[model samples]
Target chain A: MKVAFPYFGYDTIALKNFLEMLGAEVVLPPLPTERTLSLGTKYSPELICLPFKITLGNFIEALEAGADTLFMAAGARKCRFGYYHFIQETILKQIDNNVDFYPISQYTPFEFIFQKMPKIFSVSPARVMKSINFLLAHSRLIENFRKLVRQARVIDFTLASIHEKHALEIIADAINLMQIRKARKEIKALFNFADDLPENIIKVGLVGEIYLMLEPFANHDIEKELGKMGVLVLNNRSLYRHIKHLLHIDFDRIKLNHRAYKYLKESPGGEALNTVGEARTFIKNGVDGIIHIFPFTCMPENIALEALQKMSDDYSVPILSLSIDEHTSKIGLLTRLEAFIDILKRVKNQKAVSRVPRSSLLTPH
Target chain B: MIKIGIPRALFYFRYGEFWQHFFRNLGYEIVVSPSTNKQILEQGLKYVSSEICLPVKIICGHIEVLKNQVDAIFLPRFVELNHGLYTCPKMIGIVDIAQIQVGNACEILSPKIKDNFMLAHFQTGLKLTGNPIKVIKALNRAIPYLSHHKKLSNSEDHKQRILLLSHFYNLWDDFIGKDIINSFQSCGFDIATKEDLPDKVLKSDKGFAKNIRWVYERELYNAFQYYSDKVAGICNIISFGCGPDSLIGEIMSKQANEYKTPFLQLIIDEHTSKTGINTRIEAFSEIINRNYQSKPYLTK
Candidate 1:
């Protein structure tokens, strides 16, 4: 059976590798574009979040591309992400497109391992484990590529842009764990500064919905734009971290929980808690500003926005919260980014006179 | 008696009776905010973020009304009602929203309940009163009042039935949904609520429908699924900016089509007019009647 999944930056490469190893022909969904967004928008409920619409568009395109089996993450709890496959499947059925929809429950690893994966792929547990490990190792490479690119973009935009292409190529060609490790080193070396950076550069922490954090196309390539504007962007969200979270191997969540405790007591679903935690952490690290981005009408992130606004006032930090949808204008986004950067620059310049002592900014709150 | 403020919003509909009894048992006087009014709406608009739902906005108004008149506001942060089933993120973080809105005007008796529903509540109860024995006595005395909620089946066997699916806060609230519900009732339709369905019914096999995570949404889905064939039509009542209902409303609309039942999705907000709601209900009611008239044999 030809299987397909939604495109989520370089995570798609790792997923493609995993499915290919399972002996199934993998048909990648077309890259999310205006066409995909429009198609999804046309079919989706008017108020649904942007990720659902784009992912629906991905499924429609993937189905059109002759893939009879569509795989989407499933389980309806915590956030709306779990129930997306269900809503999208109904939409697809309305258009009379038929496909075997399999929702992989990311929450239930044990059930997925011994039963779900073996039954669906007709593969043994060992093969599934190896495929997952391969994906994890490859994701680490992808994460490294992103970190290197983040720094490289700020230091040298041309080198970062050129290296991103080479890194994507490197990730796509690496199928096994060992090959992924080798690719990681090569990819890292391509953009790795391996040195201390200049002190005057504005440091910005990017936090929000995970999809918006990882997928550049969804957020109109905000990272590249920031890099072009000469700001060093720090983003911790990635598929690799998500994979580690699923395995309960990531301790970042614990640290985030501890850090965000003063501001937000619980995970309000999605990455809202993470956003708040990182915002606090960012403040302590003396980041010039924090940029909170999420899909329009995203409940979790919207809830976090309240705390974010309060944090900005209480902590004397500048935060720009942008809600994106199909109607989000590129010009408007760019203008806001330019204005935000201008404000951050002004704020940085005046920090010496500002009441927030520089010494306290370095220490954790 | 220390007058405790209870916003006539959110879980006030779900657990209003119990809360009133619980607090009253401990010798504290309960002061409930008046139904949604113009002043509350305008006051709430000033404090709450615009992205939140109409119910939350109105609730914020209610809290604003109670800020000064009462001793403390009772806002519980509900994490989960079921395993893997969550209240919307909006509901989970409402304490923070209310806190922001009220500021230092009054003490907010906001209890954080992550899990273990009763114990968390009991802890809140103890916090209300230093004496554990008084809290235990109050809880035991309040249990009967909480259990007093019994949804009786509508006795209209001949009238056309329309399933009204909404969060309790929306449907039960007079200011929010009273107009639509009263109009439908006046129009002579038997309205079936999600509350009418037992909780276990939601967890049953729903065939190929996607696993709905939100507790209230899942219950609404099951109620819609269970009643689509049984009812004449379905009316999904949602606040204009509700995130969960926006998705579930679409699913319900689709499911209604499979059953060939007339479905009306009514979005209520600050801007929704009584006339507009009346016209839609009239149109929907007419369609339901015509639907039954077109197939008299199916009615029985």
Candidate 2:
């Protein structure tokens, strides 16, 4: 099968592995842009969050590019996102196009295959168990790969403090080249470089949907701009987190990410839980402030913003809510970002910041 | 006397007269925000932190405009009116969110409706008014007052019918003329609406009443149920960027599948086009005259 993965708001690293492992030629969605938004606008309901539109656009474009088997993970949360898979299915079917959808939701089809391991593998239960044991043993491969990625982040966050554009780019490229090795010599070099960063660097936290947090274009290169201003932007999210939350549904995950699949199932406002959790994490980590980005009409973010006011007031960690739509102007966004950075800078210089004791913030219900 | 501020949004547009009359009958002063305008919208946007939908933004704007002018603001936290039919989560959460977001320090009224009680929970009214008799009296007067208005609305001779399906603004306001009904009448059409129906009658209808409190669906059912044979064409007006309307609008449009009557689904926004709206109305009116009235009503 020619598999297509949604380029939601981040780089498709794990999706590439999944598709390639499944013995399929993978095609990613077109890079998000004004054009991508327009394509989604043509078919999707105008009221849906921008991410839905972008995802719809990606699915359509991928299908047009002769890819089959569109993969979408269904979430159950207070966020309307959980409903996107169903909505997209109806829309795609209504378009009368023959595209196969492989939605990986709460009850994945893979469950059946995994459950009937011996039958599918045509081996004895003992042999299947042995193979499962082997896979579990080397599940270390995924973990090792994950740690290498984390190390890259530490190196990247450190280099971002240098405020040298070209040098940072070189560091990023080098870090990317570092292979996932248990005893990799490069990991130590990167760690040493990170430990040498200046003590005065201000750290700003970015909390939002995985897509918006990672996708520079969607958020107008916000993290980079913050980094350019000498702010160490800590993004506490990842594809691994997305997949991990998806594979093992947790109720508490909703409290962390109101947009998490499980919470979206229970209701629509739970995604805000994740937003609150992210802001709290940033506050706890001594980050200066948090920026929450969501597409216009994002229910989870709206709910999160409600909780954030109390969180921000109690934590004394200023939070800026940034919502993007097709009509969002880069100039306006930049101006707001500049203002927030100035606020963060002022607080850092004053050193008089009275971080609200954590107990004062809104406790998750 | 503690004055209450009622925002001229959402249910207020539809039930303003009943609400005002009800409260007035109880001898309490009512302060309503002026019609939605640029200044009002800006005032709300200023107070409301970013990242909410326009309606919520508009509500915030109303609150900003009315904040300090009243002792408390009424944000009807409508959970469900009829069984299983629910209000949008935005409506349910808006009161709590608004209280937190603005930190206005003003009192808010959230009428919790549950356990098959029809009135806005007499306890909530008692809390607001501080007298059980007054609450009961006010609620009693409001109920019949609403029924009377419904009768008047139903009996209206909508000569030049403009089946406005727009959001609260297009339905309630006569930017076309101050009174949408009068404006439609002047244009030679009778203005029929979902609110014009007697709730008792709808409840009596086993099928229609079953989905009665599903507000949007109820409106749609009312449109089809009462005025299907009378109106020229049903203009399904919806606001742009409304989430509830997404599914509700689709369901409504699909309801038009069998009704050979002229059905026009018009989407409204902050920036409305009078010319486009007029043209659509004209076309729909022409179609309704040609196709409707000649056919018999068929329930699907």
Candidate 3:
């Protein structure tokens, strides 16, 4: 069976490997482009969030590449994400009648491992467990690669870009757990510029909707742009953490909710609580600033923006919120980023100047 | 007597009468904000981000109107209404928004409605009355008023009938939806809404209906499933920027296409003009009439 799924930034390699291990010929969709966004926009409902449009575009591109089966993640609550597969499937069937659609629910891991995955691949549950283990290890490796890239980019963008390309190839080639472990060490050595990094570089917490956080295309490569500006972007959302969250083994979830309890008591269902929690934590840790990004019509994140505003007020932190959609211009986004970074730099410098003694300031060389 | 203010928007349309009765029975003066107006809409817009849906903006405006005049605002955080069925995320977070906006101006009596609706209401009642017995008595007195089983007017009198699919707030609110309802009625068409249908019709565990987990959205989907073949056409009134309606509207229109029934989606926002809605309603009625004339035997 020819299987296809949407592109999720660099972590697509992990999902592609997971599907391939199940003995299915996985057809990877071409990386998202202007053509993909336009195609998705042409067919999607006018007001649906950007992720839906992008994923729908991915499915269409995959179908063009001879994929007969489509797998999409589903079953989230209090967000439009859970209902994405139902609408996307209906729209897709009109384009191709012979395609098979399967919505892999995010919450039901047991059914996915024992029932759905085994039934679809005609494999034993034991094989499914092994594939899942491979997926987790691969995703963890990718997460580390992202951290190294984020750090190295702030030091040397050109050299980091070159290493990023080489590291991604290494991550994709590693199949077994031993290779994955060895690849992690190689990736770490490849980005070892710890001595070149400054002590007090400008750091900004990136918090928002998970899709916008993980998918660089959706956010117009904000992390790379920030790195180019000599700023460190700390993003905590990744497939590794997301999978841990779904399995209910994420220990940090309680602490996040506890930190966010003062501003937001209950989860509005998406990552709003997480966004608030992460922003508050970032502020407490003395980050220079915070950047909040989400789709234009996102309900939960918009609500989170309100709480973040209150938190920003109480903590005296500067926050820049970007509401992205198809209409958002790259030039405008960069201009806003530049202005926000300038403000953050000024704020950091002012605090530094205030901390030093007046005698030390007069004795500056 | 301590006065309790209830904004006449969102859930107020669904349970406004019950809340009024319950609060009055508990010996508190209940003050409901006036229906949505331009002033209220502008006030709501002032305090919120621009991307929020129109209904939420209007509710925020209503709260602004009643904040100073009352002792506390009765804004309940509706999390879940049925088992595994959640309200819209905005509905769940709106109480917090109201709290942030209305700060020390007024106290917000927000009871989180999760599994047991009666228990939440009783708790909110006790906050005002200070007596468990009085809260229970008031709840018992107002239980019957909570059932909003509205009957559709006789469908035989009109030559065409349209299923007016919309949430309770959008349909009943005079400023947001009254124009379209009036325009449809004036065009010699009878209208049926989700409120007119009984719980059995709305709770049908059919194909796509079973997948919908939002309580009100499920009702819209099931109503569309039931009336897709029976009605002459379907007109869905959704506020701009609503996350759930964006998907549900697409699903309904796709199904309406398969059923060969005419479909019209009217997107309303704070900037939506009255004449614009009336004009669209006029054009939609014409299309439905043409379809009816072409295939008289298809629709009953």
Candidate 4:
């Protein structure tokens, strides 16, 4: 059976590899563009979050590409994300009657690995486990690539873009564990420009809903834009960290929650707690500013905004919160980014200027 | 006597009476915020970010009304009322928001009700009274009122009955819901809400709708499923920017189409004018009446 799933940023490579390893011919929907977004927005509920619309568009495109089965992730508590598949399936049925929709429940890893995967692909449990292991390794490789690209782009945007393309090719071509292990070193060597990096670089923490955090199309490539502005964008959310969270092995998450406790005492159920935690940590680590991004009408992040506001006042850090929807214009986004970067530069320079002794200022000619 | 304030928005429509009884039994005078008004809505709008749903903003308004008048605001963080079912994320974090918004004004008695609802309440009670026996007596006295279900008018008796689907807050709140209900009533139709249905009716399992994780939204889906055929039409009232209602509204509309039932969705917010709602309600009611007359058998 030819299977299709929504594109999840660069992590789509890992999921595609996993499905292919299970012996199902995977149909990758074209990268989300204006057409995909418009198609999704047309079919989607007017007020649903951005991820649902984009993913719906992805499914519509994939179905047109002759894929008969669709796999969408599901089961996030207290978030609308868990219920996306049920509604999407109903909408898709009106469009195409023959397509099969499988909601991959994110929380139930055992059921997913042992029962669902094996039954769908007619593969053994051992094969499913092996494929999952490969998926984790591949996700880690992609995560590392994202970090290196963010740093490399700050140094030299054009060269970093070229390296990013080549590294992605290496990641996509690696099918086995051995190839993945080799690709990691090769990708690292390609971005080895740490020695050339200047000190006292502008650092900005990027925190928000995981989908908008990872998806460049959704957030209008905010990281790349920030990198182009010569700011080091520190984004901690990735498929690897997300997988670790699901597996209950993310130790950093506990620390984050504790750090966030002063601002937000309890998790408002989405990544709101994480956003607050990560933002606070970034502030403590002396990041110049924080950028909070989420879909418009996103409940958890909106709540997190309040906490972040309080944290910003306490820590004296500037925060730029952007709520994105289909109507969000690239020009508008770029203007805001430019303005925020300008403010961060001013703040950083003022601090640097204030550090000099009064005698040195008096002798400055 | 110490006064406890209860905001007359959100879960107040569902559990307001129980809280009143529970607090009264503990010898504390209860103060419920006045019905939502323009001033309260504006007050809420000022304090919260513009992205929060109307119900939350209105609740914030209600809290603003009570902050100075009462000693403490009884805003419970409703996490999970049933097994495997959760409240909306906004509801879970509202208490924290209130704490940050109006912490210095008054004390917020927020009992987080997770899996063990009674224990949470009891702990909150113990914290207040420090008398376990008195807390148990108050709990026992107030427990029965928790499930005070409203009786649904018989659909067979009324020729033009419409199943009104919405959260309790939106349905019962005078300012937000009164106009829609009045418009329907003036149109000569009886309304049946989820509250009118028996608990057993709402709890009965349906196919995929049973998988809905949000407690109130699942109730709405179940109510729509049960009453779609039993009523002349379905009118769903939802606040603008409600995260859960966005999806639930879509699902219910699709189901209504399949069942050949007339469905109307009214999206309300702080800026929704009464005249706008009345005009839409008039058109909707007229359609429902006409459909009932022409295709009476179709409803069945």
Candidate with the greatest DockQ versus the true structure? 3
Per-residue C-alpha lDDT of model 3 across residues A324-352, encoded as one tens digit per residue: 99889899999999999999999989998
Which clashing pairs does model 1 show?
A76-B213
lDDT of 2 at B236: 73
Tens-digit lDDT track for model 1 on A1-365? Answer: 98988888767887888889889999987788899989988998877889988888898898888888888887666677877877777677766556788888888988877898899989998888888887788788888788888888888888778878988998899877777778877876786663457888999999999998888888999999999999999988899998889888889889988887776777788888888988988888889899999998888888889988898998889999999988998889999999999999998888756867879888997
- Give the least accurate 10-residue stretch of model 1 chain A, judged by summed lDDT: A188-197
Q: What local lDDT does model 3 show for residue B175?
A: 84
DockQ winner between 1 and 2, please give it.
1
Per-model TM against the reference: 0.92, 0.69, 0.97, 0.96
- Summing lDDT over every window of 10 consecutive residues in candidate 2 chain B, give the lowest-scoring window: B149-158
DockQ of each: 0.65, 0.18, 0.77, 0.76
Order of candidates by lDDT, top first?
3, 4, 1, 2
The prediction achieving the highest lDDT against the true structure is: 3
Assign candidate 4 its CAPRI class. Answer: medium
Ranking by DockQ: 3, 4, 1, 2
lDDT on C-alpha atoms for all candidate structures: 0.83, 0.60, 0.90, 0.89
CAPRI class of candidate 3: medium
For every model in order, what is the number of clashing pairs?
A: 1, 36, 0, 0
How much is A258 displaced in model 1, in angstroms?
1.1
For model 4, residues A163-280, the per-residue Cα lDDT tens digits are: 9999999999999999999999999999998436688899999999999999889999999998988999999999999988988889999999998888677787889999999998
Sliding window of 10 residues with minimal summed lDDT for model 4 chain A: A193-202
Q: Rank the candidates by TM-score, best first.
A: 3, 4, 1, 2
A1 Cα displacement, candidate 4 (Å): 2.1
